[model samples]
Target chain A: MKNYFSSQFKLGILGGGQLGKMMLYDTRKYDIQTYVLDPSNEAPSKVACNHFTQGSLMDYETVLNFGRKVDVLTFEIESVNIDALETLEKEGIKVYPQPSVLRNIQDKGVQKDFYKKHNIPTASYEKYAFAKAVKESPQWLDNLPFIWKSCTGGYDGKGVSVVRTASDLDTLPEVPCIAEKMIPFKNELAVIVARNVSGEVKTYPVVEMEFHPEANQVEYVICPARIDETVAQKARDIAEKVSNAFGHVGLLAVEMFQTENDEILVNEVAPRPHNSGHYSIEGSFTNQFEQHLRAILDLPLGNTDSKVASVMVNLVGDEGYTGPVKYENIEHIMGMDGVTPHIYGKKETRPFRKMGHVTIVDHNIEKARTVAEKVKGSIKVIAQ
Target chain B: MKNYFSSQFKLGILGGGQLGKMMLYDTRKYDIQTYVLDPSNEAPSKVACNHFTQGSLMDYETVLNFGRKVDVLTFEIESVNIDALETLEKEGIKVYPQPSVLRNIQDKGVQKDFYKKHNIPTASYEKYAFAKAVKESPQWLDNLPFIWKSCTGGYDGKGVSVVRTASDLDTLPEVPCIAEKMIPFKNELAVIVARNVSGEVKTYPVVEMEFHPEANQVEYVICPARIDETVAQKARDIAEKVSNAFGHVGLLAVEMFQTENDEILVNEVAPRPHNSGHYSIEGSFTNQFEQHLRAILDLPLGNTDSKVASVMVNLVGDEGYTGPVKYENIEHIMGMDGVTPHIYGKKETRPFRKMGHVTIVDHNIEKARTVAEKVKGSIKVIAQ
Candidate 1:
C-alpha cells in the first residue's frame, strides 16, 4: 500500500480526456505519480497529472515507450493499442482491464461474441466486414431496422448508426462492424461494478440512462434507476457475472437495456470509469474514481451505496461553438440547491464536445430529476 | 483561472501537517502547483504537494524566502510568522486569513480578549505569562477545576493539562497560556464556515466531537451533531459571526463547547480546512477541500449540504508506539460498509500522533455512529 502512495511507483494512463483528468484527481490525492499520454496538447488531463506526455495512445511505439516509464498501466479510454499493452505486460508491467479485455471491448463484433460465449445476456447481433457484405447477403438483413456499430474506435455516437431502411447503410462508414437487432426496451440502465485483485467486489445501484431522442446522447443519468426491485437485482447480478468473466481489476461499467418484456440485455461495457457513475461522486458513499483507485491498488472495495438520489447532466459544447469555452448560467445553476458542476478545465469547445457535467442530488429522486431537467434546459457550454 | 491551473502559479503553504496534506488534495485536484514549507522532511504534506521545501515557518527570513516563490500564500499551522505574511501581503502576494487574524490567534491571551471585546459568548478564563505566576496567585486561582492550555505551538494533548489539583500545575509547561473554567457539557462541537473574496459565505453542519476521556483525544466527529435543532442553529449563527469578524477568505473551523443546559460557547478557531470537516469528503455535497479552493480562487462556492450523516474518527498512534508504523486490521476495517480510511502516508508512528482519519457515512446517523465506534475499537496504528 505504501508503494502505491507518494512513492516512486508510477501509473501510466492512456487518453487524457475528462475521465483521465478525473482519474488524475485520485492519483494526486494519494500522491501517486502518474504519466498520461494523449494526442491533444490541451487535453484536460494534461495539467492534473504529474507528468503529461503528448503522444498518440494508438501509436505502437508511442504507447510502448510511455508504458516503459511506469510501474503499472491503466487507461481511461478503451480506444488504445492493445498490442502495446500486451507488450508491456510481457515486460512485467501490470496493465489493468488486461489487454485481452480491451481487445474484446474495442470492437463491437468481438464484444458481442464474448457475451455470447460467456452466456451473458445481450442483444443478438451479426458481424460483417463491411456495409457491402451486408447487402450481398439478404440473410444478414434479417434485422432490417437494426443498429449499426463500427467494430473498432466507436465513441459517443461517432461509429454508431441506426438503420431504418437499407438506404441507411449508405450513411455508415464501410468497416468491420455489427448490426445489432433493435430490441424494444422500456429503459436503458447501467451498473458499475468494482473488483480488486484480492477478490473484493462492490456494485453501485442501477442507474437509468435517459437518452436524447434526436442526438441519441444520454441526457440524464439517474442513479437507483426507478426500475423494479427484481430487475435491478438481476441487472446487478448479471453485471457482476460479466466482471468476473472479464477478470477485471478495476471499475467495469455494465450498460444494459431493459426490454419491455422485462428481460435485461447487456448493451455494452466500458472497462474504465463510465459516464453513468459520475453521480456516485456526489450521491454515493464511495465515488467511482476513488473506487477505481482502491480496486486497482487491491485495497478493500468501498461502499457503493448512494446517500441521496441523483441525476447527472452532461455539459457538452453547444452546436456551432468552437473557441475558448464558457459555461453560461453556471453561477445560476450553482445557486440551485444540491447542484455541483465539474468543469474539466478544457479551454476550447467544439460541437457536442463533453467539457464537464453537473450532478444534482436530493432526498427526493423526482425533485432531483426535475432539477436536472431544468439544469439541462438552462445552462449551455458555449464558446467565448 | 487557467493561470492557476497547472500554470507557474505556485501556492506556498506553511506547515505541512494533516490539514496542509488535505489542502494539497484540492490544489492537486485543480492542478494548482504548490510548494510546501515545513521543518520536517517527512511531513504528511511533503508527498502530495508539488514542491517540498524544508524550512522553519516561524523564522522570518525562512518564511519570507519561501513566500517570495509562490503567487499566493496560506498556512495550516498558526504559529507561522505574521510579520512574514504581512511582508508578503505588502509585496502584492495574497495571504489568506490576513495577517491581522493570525496575529490575534497566535497568542491565546489575545484570542480570549478579542472574544470578550466582540461580546462573543465564551467560557470565562484567566491568562498567565508563566505556570509559576499562576501557582503564586492564590486570588487568581479558582477552586473549581480548569483546563490549562499553552498559548503557543501546542497540538493534540501536548502542552495542555487538566488542573484538578495543585499538583497538576507542577507538570504544566511554564509558558504564557490560559486556564479556562471548564464547562460541563453533554458534547463538544465545532462549526466550519467558508467565505470568499466575493462575499460568498457557507457553514457546514455542526459536528459533535466525541473525546476519549483518558487520552484526551477526539475519538469521533459526528456531523449534524445529535443535538436539538435550536442549538445547532445557534452554533451556526455564532460561527458565521466569528467568520465575519475574522474577515477571512477561506475556511474557518470554530471549535465550541455545548453545555448540558444546551448552551454553546466558542472555544477557538482554525482559519483553514479543519479536521472536524473531514467527513465532507464522504458526506457533503461539496467537500471542504474543494470549497477552500473555491473560496481562495473567488470561484462560486458550492453547496454545503450533507448528503448523509457522516462520522469521522481520527487515526492516531496507539500509546507506547514509536517506530516504523503498521496499521493493524486496516483491511478488516475497510471491509466494512461505508468505511473509508485516509492514510496520510506518514511512515513513522509516535504515540498519539495525528496520522490520518476514517470517515463512516450512512443515511442513518445512529448506524454510522455505531460503525464508527467499531472502527475506533478495532483498528490500531502501531509500531512495527
Candidate 2:
C-alpha cells in the first residue's frame, strides 16, 4: 500500500553482515531504498545499500537515531539493542520479527523455557546460574557427556561444548549455562518458516545438514531432506507450530534433530535467514531472502517449491591460512555444470572463517549431492 | 587468475542504467570492486557500485579518466565514446567486447556492411547521406513501404520510421540514414552468445519477441521460442557465427527475423546484455549478467541451458499520466505463482517509459506464458 518501490520510502537495517548483504540484493531488485548500520566500515553490505553508517548495533542511542530515519526497521542479526527496538515500536516505527520474539530467543535458557512453555518438543535440559553451580551439583555430574551451552553471548560454535568428562568442566566459561541431555540423533534437519504481518505463513522443505566427521562443522545442506514422507511432514508441522507460537514476522529458521526413532526435537531457531536455507537461492522458486522481504513488507508470499534439487557447501578458510583470502580452483569448479559460488567479500581468511558458499543444482538430488562434494573438494579458501 | 574476487582488481563500467545495476549484483556477489560512470547522479547503479563518477560517457576525456581508474573496463550501453575505449585498450586496460566490435555495431550502416562482407543473410538496404537523398533517388520511390533508420545515435525506438508514403519522408530527420527493404516475417527472435577472452564460446537458447497487436511494442519475450528444434538450432548456429566473426569477448545478442519460409536473417546485434535475454534471470542455469561477467573476466562460463520455461513482460509507464511513478497492483501480481517483479528504481513515470520488468517462470512453457499474460494485464505503471 505504501509506495515502497522506487519511491521515498526508506528501510533501515541493523547489522551489515553477509545476511544483510544478501538481503540488499532483493531490496535492489524491488528498487527499495535501504540504510544499513554496522560497526565495521568494510562491512560486506556497505556498498550495496543506499546509505551505510559506521556504528554499533548494540548502542541504544545509535540504533534509536537510525530507526527514526526510516519508515520500517529490521535487523539481520539478533545482537541488536532490544531496548531501542522497543522504544522505536512505541514511537510507531515498524520493526519486524518484533522485539519480544527476539528477547525470548536471545538467551538460551529463556529460549528453552519458551519452548517448554509452548509445548514444543525439545531436548530435556537443566538450567544453572553459573558453570560453577553445574560442576558442584551431583545431578549434572551424573549426566556425563551432556551438552553445555552458555545462556547468552554465544555464536558460531562459541560458548558451546560437549562435556565428555569432568575435565571438560574446567574449560567451561564462568557464565550462566544450560546442561542439555545429548540424545543420539540420526540426522540434523532444519525448516525455514515465513510469517507475514497479516498472519499468512509458509514453510520451506526440510533440509538435512551433513556435518564434517572430524571438524563437527556442517559440510553440506541438502533440501527435501532424504527421509520418509511422514517424517518430513512431521518436521514441517513442528516448524509451523514453532512459528505460530512465536507469532514473529519475517523468517524463522527452525533447526531440529531427527532421532533414531524418527521423533523430531527442536534444536534451536534463528529469527532470520539461516545457512540451512541458502540452497533456496538457486533451487527454490522463491529464495529465503526475497521471501523474508515479502513477509516483512506484508506482500503475498511467493512459491516455496523447488525448481531443482540443490546442495550448498560452505567455503571456509583452510587451516594454517590466515591472511588475504584467495579462492583456488574456483574457476575449475565453476566450469562444472550448475555450480554457483557466492563469495562474501570478507578479504581476509582466518582458519575456518566463512568466506563464501557454493550451490550445486541438478534435476536429480543424488547428482546434485555428488557435484556438491566435487565442489567442496575442488575449491579451497586459502591465504594469498 | 588475477585475483579478481575480493581483491585489488577494479572493474569500470560506462552507462550506469538497469543493465549495469543488474551486473553490479554479480560483482557484489564476488566482492569485486567496481567504478561506474554515468551522466545522471540518480543512475540506478550509483548506489550498488563501489565508486560513482558523474560524467558524460560520450566525452572522450571523461571516459578515458574513468577507464584509467579501473583494471578492466566495459560498458552497459554501446553509445559510449569508441575513441576513449581504443585509447584505454592501447594503454593496456582490458576492455571486453573490444572497441573494434563496438565500432562495427554502433552505426547501423556499418553493421549492415559487416554482415554483407561476411556473407551473412540480411535484408537488402541502401545507404543515403540524408533524407533528401533518399527521397530524390528513384529506386527508393519504388519501395514505398520500406523502413527508415538513422545511421547512428538511434535508441529506444527513436530515429526509426516506416515510410508508407512519399509524404512520410517529410517527417524524417535529415541525417545519414538507410532505407531497408522490409521483409515479410513470421517471427522476431534472438540468441545471446557469450565468448570469453580465451575464445571459449556458448549460446543461450533462442527467445521469441511477441509484439503488441496494436501498439507494435514488444509485449513478451518467450524463452525456447515455441519453435521447431531445427529452427532453434539454426538460429543458435547463426548467432555463433556472428560471435566468431566479431571475435567478441563478452555477450553479443543477435536479433534475427524468421521469414515465412523458415529462413533466418540477421536483423541487428547488441554488444552487451539485451532485453531479449531478461528471462534468463529466472529461467536459465546462468543469467545474462553473470555470463557477461564470466566472459569479460575470462573466467569459465557457466551452463547456458534453461532450468525452466520463462517469459518476461516489460513494465512501461501508462500514457495518461506523467510525473512521480507508482506501481499499481504490483502486490497483486506478486501473489501469482512464480512471478518476480524487478523495479528499475526510476522515481518518475512518463508515457511509454520503461520502468521495470516482470519475469514469470514455470515448468510448462504454455503455463508460463499464461501467467505472463495475467501479470501483464494485472500490473500498471503510472504516475501518482
Best by DockQ: 2
**Each candidate: how many clashes?**
0, 0
lDDT tens per residue, model 1, A1-384: 334553567888898888887776577555567888999997877765768899998899999999999987899999898999999999998888789888888888989999999999998788899965677657546656788888987888778887877877877788998888888999999999999878888899999998877567788999889999999999999999999898888999999999999999998999999999998878888889888988887778888888899999988889888987777777667667788777776777898887788899999999998889889988887766
- For model 1, the interface Cα RMSD in angstroms equals 3.9
Give every collision pair in model 2.
Answer: none
Q: What is the DockQ of each candidate?
A: 0.32, 0.84
Candidate topping TM-score = 2
Model 1 lDDT tens row, B98-121: 898888787878889989988889
For model 1 chain B, where is the 10-residue window of minimal lDDT?
A: B1-10
Clashing pairs in 1: none
- In candidate 2, stretches whose alpha carbon ends up further than 4 angstroms from where it belongs are A136-139, A213-215, B213-216
Predicted structure with the largest lDDT when compared to the true one: 2
Model 2 chain B, TM?
0.98
